[model samples]
Target chain A: MLYFTAMSDDNTLYEDLLRIRRFEEAVLDNFPKGVFFGTTHTYLGQEANAVGVLDDIHSGDIVFSNHRGHGHFLAYGGDIRSLFAELMGKTTGVCGGRGGSQHLQWQNFYSNGVQGGIIPIATGMALAEKRKYSDAIVIAFMGDGTLGEGVVYEALNMASLWQAPILFVLENNRIAQTTPIEMAVAGDISARFKAFNIMVRELDSSDVKEILPVAAELIAEVRSLKSPRTLILNTYRFGPHSKGDDIRDKHEIDQLRVERDPILIHAHRLDSNHKEAIELKVEKYIQEAFNQALADPLPDASKALTGSINHQ
Target chain B: MPTVLYALNAALQNALASDERVVIMGEDILDPYGGAFKVTRGLSDSFPDRVITTPISEAGIVGIAAGMALRGLLPVVEIMFGDFITLIADQVINHAAKFRWMYNDQVRVPIVIRTPMGGRRGYGPTHSQTMEKFFIGVPGLRVLAPNTFSDPGDLLSKAIFEDNDPVLFIENKLLYLNTIHDSNRLSEFEFFEQTPEPNFYHHSKHNGTIADLSNNYAPTCMLSLRDAPPPVLTIAAYGYISEFAYQAALNLAYEYEVFTELVYPTQLSPCDMGAILSSTKRTGRLLVVEEGTHNLGWGAEVIAQTAENLGSRLLSARRIAALNLPIPASGPLEEAVLPGIEHIIQAAQKMV
Candidate 1:
């Protein structure tokens, strides 16, 4: 049950989380100043969800992201420079400046074209992988807000009925932008897929120690089902969703953090001094990554207009 | 010799005959009832196992095709109508367009989306819609519309053979049953023991002619702007309206000595800029003709871009696309709403 005893020592995981937090902080610091025009839905507080899940993901296993996908993209071994380029809308960006932050993509495995947009895309990819990988699976990250979209449920129904190799990871941070989960969505969410005979699970997401094992178990169970499965990761948004807002709702984020910080949950479980050292190290790492991102060149003013229309 | 649908059938047959890997998927594309348009006809008999039918779910069909293509299976998924394409637009735009670029060029969504577009049969709004301008904004998706059967057969062959990207092949319903021959070149599928010499081919002539009526075109004389009498305006059109534009332009030339030229485009998506640019250069004034509803329609793009690029220079520019409304299902109402020769004449007069 204790699959992820303490990954704080894992250099790669810590570096990834630290890098994401810092990178996004830098994005926020520069956005209003006209330094970055692309809309970046920063993935700050949900680092553990991305790292814990993506760490176990095979490189061959296709990954799709929602608007808040910086964590998922970076955790899934995507390069940081391209991520930066994407936010800045540069030709060197993954999509050659065509797709900005929200549309960051590289190949079929990388479709950030719309919100909840990549669910069916992931299913489509899973349909491709079903015969070939046999063992591997497609993991799609969806926000709680996206469940309302028709295509999400449609793709899920088709995936379950056909028994496609897909894992629908619902990142229910309890808010769809400004609307709370209870306000935005109604009734039993798990029963949604269960009605279709697809397996569903909801887990407390603040604790990676708790979250990671559940993920591994559900992932295994879904893989065993060889059918579609939905795992709802009930986390909290610690940041303002993005940097544009300095304050997330008090009850929505502050109260949750006081009760359970994704990093704090893991840190508390470590040795007292070891926890202090991790905090210091993570702080130092976040600070440096943030600094580097700030120092990074703001995309050229012409970059935003690069891919419009060719009249000349 | 085959119609556009027959050409689609020929392409499917040729590709299936060449590779066991090709599979056709859509609604009612099976043997007992070839596709709604009969493009997949006879192929069910030729390749029974490869032809698949599904519940009338456009989203599910295209999503599955996107999946199948990733697995290295060439699935030419067909939608019953162009209007139904909007149901699966999210899948095509989000997945088919972004996959290869999102994953760092790792996954190839080699999907060929085949569907029929446009209006002529009085099907009206729900059944008659065109999808070119909207899809052009999608970056990773390659859009192609065929003017003749050979283009579909050859372009489809290339889409299936080499291009590892997603391609959208639009077939006009009018073109489906109409017999067409290209004097330009021979399709790879059109292998003739004795090839017709290029010089010997004659352009189909129209003596006081009228364009085909089945495609919603009006009877009009076809001629170039250079031959036109002194006229104050010109209009460009594509598909069924090409003929109407020609007719209206000729009438305008005679009635008011107004010069007008029709810019006929058989290809819709990735709109033919070459012809549009050249025609705009000559007349210096344009009114695009489209039968689709006006709001967020195809001709809007032409107007917008022309205004942005050539606004200051051109004499004037405007779009005469259909008024925004669900195309009327009734015969008379649909005809009134869609563009015709009379509409072209009036548009030319107003512009002049």
Candidate 2:
């Protein structure tokens, strides 16, 4: 268990959280209307994980994301219109729309590819950072499915051995696609990293107040210690794994939704004025973001063959 | 004639003198003993800092080279044997070759890996195996296999200076004693080596080409330059198998009507298809051979591709090659499994 110190915000944190919520809602609305193809795993229930982690990381700090990566990229100030364009394979998109729906990239920081494969690369980047003496932290975002890959262990071993300044954020959504936590995970998740002797923090990912401060402390500890750290953020999907697998059955989705609604819980914790203000601000931002993405031109003809934003 | 050891020593000496940026990294490339094979003899004494002995981790050596190349250093990493190179395959393929493309042309990995590949001195499966095919599959890699002694110097210099990619220069153990001369046959590598501080090395006119065997261009004729070659059909080969192929070619030419044109491919990966094509086209018949098992062996691939393209020209193109078995520790067994001179003679007789 971890605790968050009492601190005040300029309402920007609340606004950021609202922005994520509204953006997903807009995506859900537009997706079914044939404007978007493929699946999108919305982070409607896992807003705190994004806000909590991204707040501690600087602009120069690199982050690795997974299939459920829109919120992660968005949290790190990724250009919304460019990202949207990239998903649509438009020249205006971030990766020149080369990395469609599943793949996403922004500059040197890449959150494109399967979860586990990129973990070792993040370790390599951390190695490069240490060698170049750059003050860059590598954050590898993964889901429960990624834990099974041998790469995770290999990267973790190297990172811990090197005392690399890397943070492994495992968003334990209690389900990997349709598989439940019990069916998927064999050993205790925290115990898995204990052999590597890395610092671990298991906490309710719903509470931004709880998650933000601990992340700051852990990140600081890693920087100061020049060591790697892991934090198992127990989050929920709120929606299905993606748009294609929406798990639309009310009885099934509602049961999972009720107990694991991070945003609703956060709202319940805050005042009515705060919640309404956040919702209103977030709705406005989402509207603006959607309009901006919509107005952005489709990718130029040459960009169709381009496969990735980073490559282009 | 100067041996492969002499050529290697001269190659390193000249390369180091020409390029200040070129540095040699390996287990023992220094003065106390230049190397097990003495390829870098007297290198450490001449260029002390340039020849560095690394910890016994092939991966570390190559990885550091990759890093150094990124920092604008042309590092020549000697893995000693091709077998040990697999340990550093990740560093070589993933980091060095792909970094430039993956980083969108922001970085470059200019490094060269030199090692003696195949085996004949009873090193067995682990030490003797040839796996150039594994790496040939990888993109963004430039491989140079020097069949004769002379090209090692030239190809190595080019590999060191060439920017934006890594080069794999594989040397055959048998070719260490083999000799070559300049294109005009005026200056020999052996004589060039004997002469102190000689920079210009002549390319062998024969160039492992069968066409040159019968050509009126006596300057480029196989007989002009007296280098160590099998008597009958100097079957050009690379790695440790060169000795077998050369000897076998000679045996076949004497025992049978088939005249063997031994053309050793110095560069295996990014194979000099033109040179190979010319050799096969002239010879009309070839007995491709290697120490590696024949199921998709490097030599068989060359034979297959040649036979496919030059269907009409090919004269019984077959590989008197090794079977699908690891190199046995027993000397006789190893020889039995390996295609020998007798096998070469039989294949050549059938072809003729």
Candidate 3:
């Protein structure tokens, strides 16, 4: 069932995970020093879920993500330099500094700050693909927190009813902002999707070996049947929800960081030399991206009105 | 022969037949149900694959339509009622209306949201309301309301096929049964020809004393009685209220010798201020009417723009709108609050 079993393939996946982790670590390192004005939700522990799910996505396929989306964007080949510039609010940013951390639209990838707003939009995109008779499927990524929003249920109903070619990926990190999943959501999450007759798959996100094959299967089934499917990745976030908001017990986080670290788990499967080489390359690339982004100037105030409204 | 509803149906039919990418999505819009208003009657049957029957999720419908537009499909979404628009405001205002600008003009959301608005049918507080004023201030949204002269079919076609921006096409429940007055009583299914330009002085007096600058195409329309002296008052209105304003103008000309000029603008968002300002300068006195609540209504914008443009040339500018109260379900209470011909005439008489 495993789609990628080679040592080289594992190294590639390990490298992808490291890139997202290192890039976000760089962001966190700079944010507290006033190098970046606004806040960002770091994707520290959930890197494997993004890389695993995105590896199955084609160039033509579209992906939409929620607030904790830096990992998803990066896994889908988002430029590190543009992302750094965006975080710095530079004119060279993907959205021309209009969308800083939470809002980014690059090529076929889109992310929004709202928890469940993008679900219906991604469902609609899947519907469009179905209507066009194209095999392209859409992936909508949200956390366990998004289950609280009514629009997610509405989107699920429509996606199933229309048999839209979409894969709904829920990264259930067990915590929403500061609230635990059990505190905010009720009953079984997979059962909720099953009520709408959607096929569901559950995977432990810490294990990339399992996540990649399962995500690949679900994505293929979605494209082949032109129907909606759900992949629930049981993941965890190592960092606080955002900068300066550590509500969880530090002891528990530290324990999880040691026991369920996705990077550490994936690194064990790779050769030591290969892992070291990838780490060094990712470190150098992230450093260069940060330097370039830091050198870029902030957008001019006079051009503020340029992108406020479309002229044509 | 062609009512506004039928004209709209013809326009949709044309759009579906012409463009393979044009799709219609709404609740109960499939064949047999057609739509709540039957504006989409026989459309689903004609193009079964293109017409979509969505669940009663306004937010989902609009959000999906924006996605469809982003992926290179022209989606025409119908929200059964205007009051329900509040549910989808986040998607429309935050996503659809801002996608083009927020994405740095990399994408165009060529989507049209069609919904019926206004009071008259006693559908009650929730159903009977004119909320188009809420969307007029949204920068990227084009709000269009077709009156008797401004062909709904032509404008709907323009929004679906011609324009590349997101449009809020507001249809009045009362106006659905009415046809274009100058359409030569064409068949209900026949598509009326769109006029060349939006601004035309259809009837101009030889002495230039009475000019009827009413173009069938443009959002703004100016109507006056035949061979009347210069208008003492200019009455401006749009949507269903424009019918009342026209009637009041006729009464002012015949009964009171007020010689009133009526201006109806179909485009509400980027309002036709030039046409309104020119009429205000000639008449000096301006009276605006609307069916929406008086506070911050479309009439307020019209009066503000006219005053800003004409300044001292405007002798007196006033607005007559529905009382600032929630539309009640009771018939008498609804009539009590809504602006009518009597209110328009009385306001004009006072202004003049």
Highest-scoring model, TM-score: 3
Score residue A263 of candidate 2 by CA lDDT: 66
lDDT for each candidate structure: 0.65, 0.65, 0.83
- The better-scoring model by TM-score among 2 and 3 is 3
Give per-residue CA lDDT, model 2, range B283-340, as digits (tens): 6665666655677756766776777778988766676667678777788988787776
Best by lDDT: 3
- Score residue B182 of candidate 3 by CA lDDT: 70
TM-scores for all candidates: the values are: 0.76, 0.68, 0.92
| lDDT for position B67 in model 2 | 51
Whose DockQ is greatest here? 3
| Interface RMSD after interface superposition, model 1 | 7.9
- Alpha-carbon shift of residue A16 in model 1 (angstroms): 5.8
Q: Looking at model 1 chain B, which ten-residue stretch has the lowest summed lDDT?
A: B210-219
TM-score winner between 1 and 3, please give it: 3
Chain A in model 1: its TM-score? Answer: 0.81
lDDT of 2 at B203: 31
DockQ of 2: 0.07
Candidate 3 clashes between residue pairs 3 or more apart in a chain or in different chains:
none
lDDT of 2 by residue, A1-312 (tens): 353433447266676676677777778888866665566778888888988887767656778677788888787887766666555556566655545555665654565455565666566555555545667777878888788866577667766766778888989988887778788789889988888888899886577777888787777776656778998898777777776665546686687667766566566666778778877866776677667776777745564433211110
